[model samples]
Structure formats: C-alpha cells, structure tokens
Target: MSRTDFATIDWRGRPVRIECQWIDPERGAGTPLIVFLHEGLGSVAMWKDFPARVCEAAGARGLVFSRPAYGRSTPRAEDEIWDVDFMHRQAHEVLPALFTALKLGDEKPWLFGHSDGGSISLLYAARFPDKVEGLVVLAPHIFVEDKTVANIEIARTAYRTTDLPQKLGRYHDSADSAFWGWNRIWLHPPFRDWNIEAELGTIRCPVLAVQGIDDEYGTLAQIRDIAPRVAGICELLEIPECGHSPHRDQPDRVIVATASFITNNRRQTP
Candidate 1:
C-alpha cells in the first residue's frame, strides 16, 4: 500500500497544504523517481491506481500529489482569483516549496503530467533545466486554440446543467474551488492569448509528449508544435481512439510507453 502525507507550507504568504502519496514505497532510493502531476480538475484521488501501476511497471519510485486547491489539500480562498500565470506560479513557486518541504532535494525526478499539469511541468523543466531527468506530458497545451476555448465553454455548461460538479466533488475537498478556479481562468478572455511555445526552447531534458487522437480539449498541434522548438528532446505519442486523458483511456499503452521511455532514457543518462 502507498503512504499518504501532507506538507503544510506558506505559499503566496499564506498557509497551504499539499496532499501527497508515495507509490511502491518498497522501492529503493537508487531507483529513479517519477512524479505525477494531475490535470486542471484532477486531484490525488483522481489518479486512482495509475501511478502505482506505472511505478510497478517502470521499477521506479512514484510521487503523486494534489496541488493546494485540489483533493484533500487546501481550499481556494473566497476572494482568490487565478490569473493567466497560475500555471507558471505553480511551476516556479508552489512545486519547489513542496519539494523542499518533502525533502526531495536529493534527486531530479521524471515528471509525468497531464493537460495543465503538463504545461506546468514544461514550464518547470524550462525554468530549471537540469532539475528534471525527463518528462512525459499528455494533452499539454502550448498555445490556446479556438477548439480549446469552444470545448471549455461546453464544459462550463456541463458543470451548470449536469452532474459534473457532483462527480468532481468525490475527488475534491471543495469541488467548487477546484472547478471554478480552473474553469474561470481558462475561459477568461485574456487566456486565449496564453502561450508557452517560446519557453520550450530552454528544456534540456528528454520529453515524451502524448495526446489522444480525439482529445476534446486540444489538438495534435499541442504536442506536434513541441518538436520544432525542443528539437532532439521531444518525442510524440498519438494514441488511436483515445481522448483527453490517455492514462485513463489507454492505461496499458501509456504504462508500457512511459516505462519504456524512462528505461531507455535512464540507461543513457550516464
């Protein structure tokens, strides 16, 4: 069984809690560590057993954590509003603080991130080039698209008219906080211009960018555009008949591909 813990720290000058878990705790420290980052509306619970299964397959240590306002972690303040730089702040500030609090300074971790989480991982790897061993991103958005906005608008309607909130509540401490915080920001007019393509140039580690062929939230260009900027560092995985969440939709394939990618790269890490 995995061990669950909480890290209480000050972020943005206020106390916040991050819920984290260690998968395959029996694995030795010498094994590479894979940190799992959830999507915009995802929490620790949202990942289910995928992290553990991946770690087992890869023979790696796994760290799965919920960001401040998701899962069993802290709730967003009533007046708090997420800005365009929310993902950047998560990459630059909150994550580093969590690392420090958890005593994870000894080794560089391989990041597996999905959607917004993938974008944050990209930003983090770009900002601290040598700190990550490699990364696997699923449905990451490098630039906003008309289709992205259109789908998100539909999601907003689903939240209002359907049981989306009730469904999400099972995974979040405050479903409203988790939903609105992510939804409102993405739907904001200014966010349409949000792009991180230029930042991809600085990433020094290997990258495996995956997306479902029929992803509702983004297009193939999300990962396709990454290759030109990052050059030799980027690889693409387009899963057939898959949707936004690859791990959920294509677990066996994701597990095998991610494990193979890490194993192949780790042997070359020197």
Candidate 2:
C-alpha cells in the first residue's frame, strides 16, 4: 500500500485538504503517468490495491487521490449542499488545483476513472484537451438516466435505514460527507438535466468507454453516445456478467484492456 500525503489548496475560497498516494515510486520518468479517479462514494482507500495493480500491469506511475469532503480529506461544512454543477466544479476547479499542488508538470496523463470519476475525467479532458493523452472510463454517466436516479434513491434508503453509513465509515473520515455530498446532488431534481456530452466534442484524446452489460446505474447508450462525438478514436468495451463497477467485477479483463490501451496510446502520442 502506498503512503498517503496531504495537500492543501484553496477551492472556491475554502482551504481544503486532499489525500493523495503514489502507486509506483520506482517507475521511470519516461513511463506514462496515470491518474485514478474513484467512484462517487470512493476514497483513495476504497480503491485499495486496484490502482497499484493496474499501474504495475501497464508499467506506469499512478496517482490516486480523495476529493475534498471524502476520505481523510477536508469534510464538507454541516450546512453545505452540493449544487447541480458539483461535478463540473470538481472537474474545472478542484482537479486543476490538485495538479498544481502536486507539481505534475507538463506530463499528459492517461485518466482511468470510474462512475462519477469517469464523468469528471471526460469533463477535464474536454476543458483541457492538451493536458490529457487518453481516457479509459468505466461506467461513466454522460447524462442522467431514470435507472440511475432509481438506484440513487434506493441508495438513499439504504443509507438511512441500513448500516451503509457504518460500512462506508470504514473508508471515509465522515461517511455522511462523502455519501450525502454525492447522493443528494445526484438525486436533486435539476441534476436530471446535468449532462456533459456536449463538452466532449472538444476532447481530442483517444477514449475507451467501458460499461457492463447489466449496469444498474446506466445503459449501453451511455458509452454508445460517446463514440460519435469525440474528435479522436473512441473504443467501447461491453463486458458481460458485470455490473456498475467494472474494475471490481472484472478486474482481470479491465486491467488487461486498460494496459493494452495505454501501451498503444503511448506509442501514438507525440
């Protein structure tokens, strides 16, 4: 396991702490650097050894971080409520600040994002096309769907009635901050119209959009709609017997596909 480090940054006028880790300390400078973005309720610890394993397989350096209000990072203010553009703010504001704080320099990273992280990766690549080399998104939501809202509503129930809070507490410093921040924003009525598909047209980096055949949160159209909009190549991977989290459901397949995608893209990068 990689040691966690803290970086303080001013996000939207508030000083927030972010938790980050280096997955491969000995990777060569020439190797591509990958940034792993976790799911909505995921923290650096929730990702566990998956990032390290994938980095090892791809022979790349990896950086995994917990967003503000999640994991051991700064917790959300008690009265705070996330707006509809919460994901947009994270992509446009928080991530740039993180890159600056980490001093990653001019290295163009290949983003490996899952769920909400995948959406953020897409938004980031769209906004800063030159900073990203490629993308491998698992179960990304280009737009909100009915099924997604339904699942999120169910999650709300589970969080309220079940030991879900206690379970998430194992990974998050303040489970309510992580869970409610993501859950409420997603279930908010206006969030139904929150879509980033139009922004994707600006992305020139190669994209590999993965979705499970039986994803409860989204349907195949989530990735299918992405292929035609991006300026660069868009590859789709539809895995059978997989659910919302492809990395956990089909780790071997995801690792192999991602490794191959990164290698091929690296050779093509100028």
Candidate 3:
C-alpha cells in the first residue's frame, strides 16, 4: 500500500497535529474498524505494514495514526516530561478529541495497542466502554516493574551512544524530542510509583492480551493483574521466544492472534 500524507487536528486549545494512516479494503464497505496505537518510541512508519496485514487477514478496516508529540506529528516541547497519567490523557482526551474531530467516532472502533499504547487502550476502553468493540493489546504495561526500569535505563544508554536516535529520525520528524521526552518520564523517580490496575475494571469489552514470554521490559504480571478486573472477558496469550515488541519479534503470531480475536469477538459479543 502507498503511504498516506500527514494531517492536522486542533487540540487542547492549540494546534496539535496528528497523522491518520489507514488501509481501506475493497472487500467490504462496512467492515469493522481497528485503530492502531503505537508504542512509546513508535511511529506510523515504525509500524511498517503490520496494520495492513492484520486488516487484510481479518477483513477489517484499520485506522493507524501517530499520536501528538510522536512520529511526523507535532514535536513535544523541550521541557516536557510526561506524567505517569500520560496514558490517561491519551485515552480520555487525545483519542476522543481526535476521533470526534475526524468524524471517526460514529463507528465503534476496536483498539490495537502496543506497550504504552496498550495501557492507553485499556484506559480508553475503561473510560469509554460503549465506544469499544474489542481490544487486542501487545506487550501492555499496567504496572511498573524492576525489569522494566532496568531495560529503560539500557535504552537511554543506547539512544545516547548508539545510532538509535538517528535511526528513529528516519521515521519521526522530531525523533530526539519524542525519544527524550518519553525516556525521561519513564526514568523519573515519581513515575516509579505509577500503576493503573484500579482503572481497568471499568473496561467492559472483550480483551485479547498478548505478551512475549521473553519480554525484557515486562512480565506476565502486567496482564495478570488486569485479567480478573475486567467485567467483560479477557484472554491472555503468551508467545514463546518473543520479546518486548511482540509485533516486531513475532509478526505472524500477532497477526494470527489478533485476526482471530477480532473475528471471534465480533460474532459472539453482546
């Protein structure tokens, strides 16, 4: 599929830009819509073509976009360090505002989120239960872990010493600003106290959670904590030999799992 251009949306009483990248299949006109939300350092370009593949397999429409302050969207302020509730803002405010602005809220959309995006998906589903069809999360984080902090520290080192930032620049307009803002907030002392397990109970949609068994940043505990909290249904799938980014490490497995999850949920959901 050819790449789409960037678009802008005014938010927070300011001109906060965002990119909407989607794959519209010809097979079905009213196919289910699944919105793709990227990880902490991810952009629409970094998602590569996984969104297209998943949508093709499931016969669904995909709405993939870069959030504000990431990718080709607006850059973050130099002094900005995200709060632990950053996911909350994305879920409750940014997402709703964007969907409404783009007139995408008319159709209920499923959420496919990874890492920080996964947590944001959870928050969105919990806060707006009626607007969600289902959720497919890849390597989501609901609580902080020591291993997560350790890996984040390593990423900081890599960004400074290696070509990580330069490589990210190929995908994002202001890769340095996005990378540093996310890194600093995650590494901050106050963020260490962050946890949102309490808020997940409000999610009344079917959830299909996937995580790699070998994930360096998180363990099964993150999904385990929210599995029982959800009033809807929650199914956890652990992919073997997979790491932090399951979609990157095991794309085929993720595609199959997500496709099946959406298909099965849509048919039987109440």
Candidate 4:
C-alpha cells in the first residue's frame, strides 16, 4: 500500500482534511488519472490494494481518498446530521475543493466509484459535463429501492449486534462517525425519494456500470436503468456469484473489465 497523505480543503466554512493516496504515480503525467471513490461506509484503508491493482492493469495513475467522516480524515461533528442533498454537496463542493487543493486544475479524470461513490461520480459528471473523461461505477444506486432500504436496515442491526463496528474501526478513525453519518442519511425517510435518473442525461462521457448478479444491497435494475438515460456510451456488466463489493468478491473480473473499458474509451489527445 502507498503511504497515505492529507489534503486540507475548505468545506462548509471549515477546514476539512481529506485522506488520500496515489497509485502508480511513476506512470507519469501523460497517463490517464483514475480517481477511486469509496462506498458510503468506506475509507482509504478499506479499499485495500484494489486501486493499485486496477491502476497497474490500466496503465493509469490512481487517486484513492477517504471523504470527510471516513478513515483518518476529519470526522463529522457529533451534532451534525447530513441533509438529503449530501451526495450533491460532495459532488459539487467537496470534490472540486479537493481537486483544487491537489493542484489538479483542468485535468479531467476518469472516475471509478462504488456504491454511493458511484452515484456521486454520476452526479459530478452530469453537473460538470466537460470535467470528466469516463466513468466505471459498481453497484451504484440511481434511485432508492425497497431492497436497498431492507439491506440498510440489516446493516444497521449488524452494526449494533455484530462486530461490524470493530471491523470498521480498522479503517476509520471514528467508526461511529463514519457509520452513523452514512447510515442515518441513507435510512432517513425523506431519502427514499432520492433519485438521480433525471440528472444522468447530462453526462457526456462513456460510462461502464457494473453490478453483481447476487448483490444483496441492490438489484440489476440499478445498472440497467443507466443505459438508456446517459447521453454518452454506457455499458453494463453483471458478475455471477458476486455481491455488492465486486472489487473484493470478484476482483479479477472487475479489474479486467474496468481496464478494458478505460482503454477503449480513453479520450484521444491531439
């Protein structure tokens, strides 16, 4: 694993520290940049070596970061409750600020996002059509579904009754902060109406959406719905015998498909 670093950016009128790391930096400036966005409860440490493996296969540079309230980055304030538009805020405000702090001016990156991160990538690409080259999203939610809610309920129970918190503590500095921040927002009654299907039409870059056939958190409709809505090329892949976390469950297939998709759809430079 690469050594982790901190990038401080101004967010919500306060300084937020983002935990980040680069994979295959030696691949040089001309190579494509793939930014890895973790799932709702994920952090930099939770991703393990998946980013590095993907970057190595794709011959691209990779950036893996833990958003606020995750990993070693700043934890959410105890009294804070994320609003319904939390994902939107991350896509529009936090991501851009991180880019600026990292000195990534005008560099349109390829986004590799999972779960909630996947939705954020779509939102960012839609909001800033010219700012992204391509996308690879895994088990992303376009709309809230009953299955999703049920699974989240199960997760809440597991977090309380099982050793889930201890396991998550291995990755996040404040497991409660990370878990509750994501859990409360997702399970919020108002969030049931949250959907990004209408906003996808604005995306101009090629998208590769992947989902596991046996994913317990969401169904195939999540990726299938993306095909007709996106303005640009969109491909869908369903892996058999896999769950929500494809990178962990079926790493080889996900890595190969992602690398190939990026290679095929990479923007041609003059």
Candidate 5:
C-alpha cells in the first residue's frame, strides 16, 4: 500500500486539502498513468488494492484520491449544502487545481472512475478534450433515473435505520458530511433533471464503460447511452451477477476487463 499524502489547493477561494496516493510511483514515465476516481461515498481507503492491481496488470502507474468531504481530506462544513452542480465543480474546478498543485502539468492521464466519479471523469474529458488519454468507467450515470432516486432514498433510510453510518465511518472523517453531502444533492428535487449526454459528445478520447446487468441503482442504459454520444471509440461491457459496485462485486472480472482495455487503448494511441 502506498502512503497517503495531502495536496493543498485553492477551491472556492479557500485552501482545501485533498488526500491522495500514488501507486507504483517507481514506474518510469513511459508507463501510462491511471487516475482512479472514487464513487459518491468512496475514498482512497475504499479502493483497497484495486488500483494497484489494475496498474500492475496494465503496466501503468496509478493515482487515487479522496475528494473533499470524504476520507481524511478536508471535511465539509457543518452547514455546507452541495448543489446539483457539485460534481461539475469537482471536475472543472477541484481536479484541475489538484493537478496543478501536484505539478501534473500537460500529462494526459487515463481515468478510471466509478458512479458519480465516472460522471465527473466524463465532464472533465468533455471540458478539456486534450487533457485526457482515455477513460474506463464502471456503472457511470449519464442521467438521473427513477431507479437511482429510489435506491438513494433507500440509502437515506438505511443511513438512519441501519449500520450504514458505521460502515462509512471507516472511510470518512465525518460520516455525516460525506453522507449528507452526497445524499441531499442526489435526492434534491431539481436534480432529477440532471443530465450530461450532450457534454459527452465533446470527448475525443477512447472510453470503456462497464455496468452490471443487475445494478439496482441503474440499468444497462447508463453505459449503453454512452456509446452513441461519445465522439471517440466507446466500448461497453455488461457484467453478469454484479451490482452497482462492479469492482467490489466481481473484482477479478472488472480488473481483467479494465487492464485489457487500458493496455489495448494505450497500444492504439499515437
């Protein structure tokens, strides 16, 4: 496991500390760099060994980070309320600042994102076409779905009635901040219309979108819709007997597919 470090960046006019780690940092510059973006409730710790395993298999180095409000990074203010554009802010604002702080200037890294992270990856790629190499997204959401809202409602209930808070506490500094930051915005009434299909049309890099056949939060359409919108090569993988979190539900298959996608795409890139 790599040692976690903090990168301080100015966000919304204030300095925010982001927790990050580098996997296989000893690898030469010739090796591709894969940036792993965690899901809504995920953090650097939640990724476990998946990033390292993927980096090893694909002959790449990896970067894993915990977005603000999650993990040991800057926690959300007690009264902070994330709006519908929060993910957009993360992609367009926070990510770029972190890269600048880390001096990753001009290095077009491949992105591996899950769920909300996947959406952010797409937005970043769309907004900065020349700054990304490729993308591998798992259970990405291009638009809100009825099933997604329903599950989020269920999650809200579970957070209060079950041990979900305790489980999330293992990864976040303040479980309430992480939970409410993601939950409230997701369930916010206007968020139902949140969509990014048009933004995807601007992406010029290859994309490999994977989704589980049995995902409770969303259907295969989440990935299926991506194929037609992306301007570049878009591949879809539907894994059977999996759920929202494909990496957790079926790590071996997810790892193999992701590694193969990264390796093949790297070879094809000029």
Candidate 6:
C-alpha cells in the first residue's frame, strides 16, 4: 500500500476539497475501482482505514472524499439548513462532479456508501447505472422511521448543549454545518414525507444493502422497501449485535461481505 495524498477537487464552481487515494495492486487484480462515500458526519478522516482494508481484501483501487462541509473539506456557512433533497443533491451533483474532476468515468467504479452516504450512493446508481459497476450500502435510509426522528431529537439536544459539538468539531471542519444540516431536516415535519422508495426503483445494478439488527436510526424496511422494487438484484445482510454503524461495529463481516460482492462482479466489468 502506498501513501495517500490530499488533493483539492473543484465542485460546482466552489472549492469543495476532497482526498483521493488509490493503490494499483501489485498482483494486477481484475476488480473495478471502489469509491467510498462517507456518513452524514463522516469525512475522509472519519472513515479511518476501512476503505483501505476493503480495497486490500477485494484487490481494488479506492477513492475516498469528504463532502462539502465535513472533515478537511470546506465548511458550509452558519445558516445553511439542508433541504429534504439534500442527499439527492449530494448524489446527483457533488459525487458526479467529483468523479468528473478526477476523470473517473472510464474506470467504472463500484460505490460503497454508509448511512447518509449510502442513500446518496443509491440515488447515484439510480441516476447513472451505466457508470456504476455495483453498490454496497450500509444502514442506508430510504425513508424516515419513528426511531430515526426520535434519535435526531436526542442528537439535537446533545449537539446544541452538550459536548457533542466539541466532539464532532474534532472531525468536521464545521461541526455546526454537519450537525445543523442533518438535524433541521430530520426534525422537520415535512421531511417526514420523504421516501426514496420510488427513486430506488430506478436502480438497475446489483446492490448489497447491510444493516444491523439493532440499528437505532432505521428499520429493515429501509432496505427491504427498495429490495423488492430493484429487479430482485438486491441482497440484504442483517448482522446481529450490531447497531447503526455496521462498518465500525462489524468490520470483519463488512469486509468479507463487501469483498464477496465486489469480486462476484469483477469479471463483468466490460
């Protein structure tokens, strides 16, 4: 594995910086590139080394980047309340722009998105199936759940008055940007009307959706709702004793399952 470097990526006329890292395998592995999209509060640093491990396991190149207001990326202003379609913007605008900036269309990368990032990945697959080789999503939210909203309130309180702001600030350049953008929409009554179930039906690639049985934010319906509509090409993996963050809670299973999914389709990358 070679060392990773930081690169400033141009996105939507703004300087939405990103960290792009890749390793050309010594063994000449046939796997397609794997692109990792981060969680709502996640950045390139928050992903830790999971992407590297997955790339190593599946013998693939990896691309990881922070979204607009997280990690080392540029921070949003103090008053940007994210709309319900915020994730859609991330999917349709930011990700594609980043890929275009990097000239990655020719590589046909596979997507690995978690939490909010997973939802973005699903939207991307639906929007650009030809460019996506496959998808591996963890704890993706296709619709809002009662528990999900409940947790958001709890998070709101903690972030507003508690040490959560401080804790999150360490990871995000603008913790307020990350926290408030995700918070207001979640607690908004209108946002409850969100349901990507229709958008997901447009996906035409093989998808591996994983969630923890003990997930605190979403339910099985999150993935199951999309599973039936996706041409029966979706695989649902529910892990026991795991919570919302499957990559952190069950890295071994995540690595194994992701490796299997990526390799299973490696030969079809024509």
The list of candidate 2 runs beyond 4 A from truth reads 267-270
Give a tens-digit lDDT track for model 6, residues 35-54: 88888778887888888889
State the lDDT of candidate 4 residue by residue for 1-270, as single tens digits.
356689999987789999999887777778899999999999998898899999989989999999999999999988889999999999999999999999998889999999999999999999999999999999999999999999899999999999999999999999999999999999999999999999999999999999999999899999999999999999999999999999999999999999999999997655
The local distance difference test score of model 1 is 0.92
> Residue by residue across 1-270, what tens digits does model 2's lDDT show?
466789999986789999999877676578888999989999999998899989989989899999999999999999889999988888899999999998888878889999999999999999999999899999999999999999999999999999999999999999999999999999889999998889989999999999999999999999999999999989999999999999999999999999999888785334
lDDT of 3 by residue, 105-192 (tens): 4578889999999999999998999998999998899988999999999999999899997898998899887788789889988899
Number of colliding residue pairs in model 4: 0
Whole-model lDDT per candidate: 0.92, 0.92, 0.86, 0.94, 0.92, 0.83
How many clashing residue pairs are found in candidate 6? 0
Clashing pairs in 5: none
Pairs of residues at least 3 apart in sequence or in different chains that clash in candidate 3: none
- The weakest ten consecutive residues by lDDT in model 2 span 261-270
Whole-model lDDT, model 2: 0.92
**Which stretches of model 3 miss by more than 4 angstroms?**
1-5, 25-29, 267-270
Clashes of 3: 0
Give the CA lDDT, 0 to 100, for residue 151 in model 6: 90
TM-score of each: 0.97, 0.97, 0.95, 0.98, 0.97, 0.92
Q: Between prediction 2 and prediction 6, which has the larger TM-score? A: 2
Give the runs in model 4 whose Cα sits over 4 Å from its true position: none
| RMSD to the hidden true structure, all candidates | 1.3, 1.3, 1.9, 1.0, 1.4, 2.1
